[model samples]
Target chain A: MGNSKLYKGSLNTIILKLLDEEGKMYGYEITQKVKELSKGELNITEGALYPALHKLEAEGLLDVEVAKVDNRLRKYYKLTKQGEKETVNRLAELEDFIRSMQQLVNPDWSIQ
Target chain B: MAISKEEVIYIDNYLKFLGVKYMDIRLEILDHLASEFENIQEPTSLGDFLRTKRSFVKRYENQWQKAKHWAHQRALIKRIIGYFYKPNQLFIPICIGIFFGFNATLLPKSLIAISFCISLIVPQCIHFYIYYKPEGIYKNIQSAKYILSIMALPSIFMYLMGIMAPIIKESPTVFYAYWFFAMVFNIAGLQEVMTLKRQIVKTYSKLISN
Candidate 1:
């Protein structure tokens, strides 16, 4: 798995970005999507994913809908308008951090 | 392979047997379990499969409880504070203040104190009943219980004010201030209950429709 600690701080932004792309997703779907997109390198555990989701919901950054799918109730979360704006800001911040880390780790290398 | 309806019940009962009491939380976990269960190639009894996830039961409960507590507390405070700024909402509390303020001079001290205490007690009882009664929608929902606990703040205020009643009654100014504060507290509590009731109704309707 990818270094969980390294990715921990970016979890919420990852979630927002995914929701922005997919429109709406449930808990398991979010975790599975992360694992698939990262090629099984990052595992978003239940312990970490839920608290972040609940916190975002509380902050009015996300809204929820419940639907019956295949004989069970599933809750799907989507970003609010505020959440959409916040996602752009968080992604920009994450990109900057990644850029800074790349410079520190390999000063001679240039993506450009 | 997708599990049968009976298998779903088995998963639910196993969780309940392990003491996962909240229906809302359990439903979320159930979906996760079922989704993953579909991927297993080998034959496995539902109970045995659930045993592997036993460790998560406590962690999920504790994490959810803490998050729910914080979220509801913040929401309650925001909604209460909101009442003061919106003129339409502000009108109710202002009317409450006016009623208490006008009665302060006319009513006897003991009567006013008793009335205030009852105002706090009645809602405490009603909130408890509506949230926990056997058939209530909130009865098995963990998050609703957390919200109800925060809704109990007014009764706590009542208890403190009751203990200090002798001192407060001695000064009309202090008495009036306490009543003013109590009015806001009581109104906030009522509004929370109403809002919670509406949310619970909407949620259960969705759950039932499914």
Candidate 2:
């Protein structure tokens, strides 16, 4: 798991990347997916997840669908057309950050 | 394990008790809580687990109150831009501009002035409604009121220009400024009217209670 502070910065990108790969997802599904992907090392806390989802939805980068699930209404969020484009840009930007971090941490090896 | 129907009803009641209205945010909060209950590794009653999860109350409250305001402001701006792509919606605003453009010369000057004042005052009244009835209003409607207030800016400017319109009416170069301002305001008012803030609550009897 990465540092909490480090993960916070990439939260939006992580969400966009996830929605880019997976179809629409609800809030809990998203948190669980992130935990699964990171081997339970990175917990996308609810405080962080919900706010990011709302912000992204407000920014027109996400679309929302309200459906009845388990006798309750669930909000399913997916990337918008603009969001799809943003995923590419954000993923590229994150990859660049990872490469830079690798270079900084492993000075002896060529940064991939 | 799935949350039982009774637990779901209790959660709904608790959320309502905590003042979580907006159907969208309320539903999300409920879904998250239910999903969390299912994932609890330890054998714990759903109600017991939920009782300790203070975050639910805080989240549901913050989402519709503070976060909702932020999202509303952003949505207003984005929707304005989005209007461009939806020509059907764009057509109404453009039609308003065109109507005022041609009518400025034909309509009585007094009537034009009256419209300018109405445009300015209507939005002010909307702000007052939200302020007056802060409670019992849906978050969607409240934000819609705020949007009405925002879209009113052009009308405010148009009202300000009413004084200047007559002075420049004779000049060919600047005569259209009044009409332009009027059109901008009219378009804004047209948008706000859709929010139904002005209509008496009695009139919208079919409207679902927020």
lDDT of each: 0.80, 0.68
Chain A vs. true chain A, TM-score per model, equals 0.95, 0.93
TM-score per candidate, chains pooled: 0.88, 0.74
Residue pairs in steric clash, candidate 2?
Answer: none
Instruction: Pick the lDDT winner.
Output: 1
Candidate 1 lDDT over A1-112, as tens digits, reads 6467999999999999999999999988999999999999999987788889988887778988888888688789999999999999999999888888888999777234
Error of 2 at B127 (Å): 11
Candidate 1 lDDT by residue in tens digits, B61-177 = 887777766676676677778878987788877787777876676888778767767766776777777777888667667767765766766666777875877978688777777
Off by over 4 Å in 1: A106-112, B41-45, B132-135, B206-210
Residue B194 shift from truth in candidate 2, angstroms: 4.5
